[model samples]
Target: MTTFLTGWGRTAPTPAVLTRPRSVEELCELIGAAPGRGVVARGLGRSYGDAAQNAGGLVLDCTGLDGWTFDEGSGLVTASGGVSLHELMTALVPRGWFVPVSPGTRHVTVGGAVAADVHGKNHHRDSSFGAHVRSLTLVTADGTARTLRPGDPLFQATVGGMGLTGVIAEATFGCVPIETSLMRVDVERTADLDETLATMAATDDRYRYTVAWIDLLAQGRRMGRSVLTRGDHAARTDEKEPPAFAPGALVRAPAWAPGGLLNGLSVRAFNEVWYRKAPRRRTIVQGIAPFFHPLDFVDGWNRMYGSRGFVQYQFVVPFGAEETLRGIVGALSAHGTVSFLTVLKRFGPGSGGLLSFPMPGWTLALDIPVGQRGLAGLLRGFDRRVAEAGGRVYLAKDSRLHADMMAAMYPELERWRQIREQADPAGLFRSDLARRLRL
Candidate 1:
């Protein structure tokens, strides 16, 4: 009845009474009678931190509620909250439709995606997952179900509410039309930070999807050197190259891999090899899987960080705050913080979820092995700088942010909190993250 649960990052593992709700009725019953620590929903457990974990409380695992419907004429998709994006794509792609927006991985549940309001490479063009959603069903603490639509205050809160408002039962969202699953990709390597920023700024509007793999270990003249990949769904209508189905992990890491395996030297070497491997300028046709979800190929790749787990630090600074972005990247290089994978992208505009992370700005994400000396202090310093620049960290990937910083990062926090309290006045919807950051 009790199990130890941790986020994808494997940090702050906690024990909870985990329940799998096979139906909306069952979920409502469980929530109405949740234990003292309160109730929260868990999807595939893909969140990097404690957003879905309810220590010493009840956790409703929503995977069993899988159900979906599609309308060919309008490209509208209605999927159960527990249904994975991979499952959705598996069905949609063959029908010549694709998710308008997707995070790096397809393993995320539709509910999880809505709750996080995830952004992808297309963010510079399409905004976030919440923007495409038409309506959603919410099962609140009081055992009632409500169908909320866009432009509703409660709907805005639930979009990125992290499940505090209640359990997301289902979502109806618009899908994009695609000729094929293949992408016509253009790759170019930038010489330095300024070049990388300028290039993306100038040309990003030309592509539907774009992202940069930045070399965080590089310093001096080579600082922020990166390989930029920009692409759009290929117009190739060849039936021979049908869209791909959901892909499985190409390989899985051992559970017992040693920790601290990504030290500075190893990371530097990896970055060096990765940078050199990219062509200076090239064009290629790639599958949507490889181009969007490369990390999905290596199952349990998180294990590579060793038993101690790793921290996924992602933050965004508004446009014109380029100075703040430069300072943070420079600081990381100086600290020799070993980040094996780093990404940089420009966001067009936010979906306006009260607590959504993306805005019209430059966002960067890094994977850092935890337990490094002064890692906490280093990240906190970065947080202060981001806050001062009118920026915020991504809640879905956060583990150590201070509660005091949330208001500054999100100007609409108090308004969102008011809606949340009105929905679940007794605070029946709760999680470790809620407690940690006082959300």
Candidate 2:
């Protein structure tokens, strides 16, 4: 019965009971006999917030169920809920197959990815994790296991239902075929907001993966200055015998980095260097590990934000609403918020999953140090602006979104709720986030 708090940026929960079940039968027993009326499944605890925390209820840590089998003929991989993408990639990459979709980090589990319906830079071309899912095995509140497929309405609801629907025990999804574990990448720099948007709009479709590194400290004429990166799976001939597996090369950060070390001064300097260092026109061949999971190179890196931790603010704005994008970036620059990681991307079509986050729009994500005065209020204001424009926030990365804002942002909320209720009629499967957001 080991207990651990979630990732940075969330208030710690004092769960009445926490259990790590190594098998589905054990998981069922724990759920059936829990003292509390509510329960939730927690994966790698990488959600950056309380979405996976069950304060007074039962919290099931599913990491022990790491099991997976691949069907080489069909290129389909069925994995246990606890298998992390890092592990999956290590196994599949050498075989010339890649996860259909992956978020920025590789430390997340299959269950967490599906529960959040995670997306990546390729979203503008491939949609989300849910889009690749073919089937899943879920454990309902009554301790019953049900296998569901894409056509099942309950399947869509559970895909991004934030674990309130049930415990995702196993999942099967299609994998993308790759010629090599290397990427043929193109890099470009944009001098201002207009150029950045124009470049992304004009060229996003030319590549399978696209993202922008925004200079959050830039102001006035230089506002929204960015470095755009576009890439696709490299052809075998593009590189000489793909880079060999070198797990030892992954570096981990020190246990502690001084608080306020990443303040305005340091961030501005770093952003300047990054913007200037990026080449206006360049093509390079790089390995998949560095390209997809840059942050994962450093272990325990979250400790750098001091004990208070940090929150990742990720929101989307529709295609035509350039004003919303400009306004948000301008506001952040005005405040001089210390955000070390600021990313911008264009999303294409969206999946019909009731709570899925992405759509045909531009999305911005930032990692801001916590406890900044009025930070919560500022994000709330941003939520309003997003909702007003028919946009929504990603629930996977949210920690402080209000219930009303959530309802306003997601018009399909009621439909998801109905399906969830039908699956867990007694409202037994729950979490602090579900209660807080009234989901």
Best by lDDT: 1
Off by over 4 Å in 2: 2-4, 10-13, 242-249
Once model 1 is optimally superposed onto the true structure by TM-score, how far is the C-alpha of residue 119 displaced, in angstroms? 0.8
Which pairs clash inside model 2?
none
| Segments in model 1 whose C-alpha atoms lie over 4 Å from true places | 237-240
Candidates in order have lDDT scores of 0.93, 0.86
Tens-place lDDT digits, model 1, residues 1-439: 8999999999989999998999999998998899889999999989999999999999999999999999999999999999999998888897889998989999999999999999999998999999999999999989998999999999999988888899999999999999887889999999889999999999999999999999998999999999999999898653357666667899988877887788988888988898899999999988889999999999988889988899999999999999999999999988888888899999988897999999999999999998888899999999999999999999999988999999999999999999999998999999999999998
RMSD of each: 1.0, 1.5
Q: Please report how far candidate 1 places residue 105 from its true position, in Å.
A: 0.6
lDDT of 2: 0.86
TM-score winner: 1
- Residue pairs with clashing backbones, model 1: none
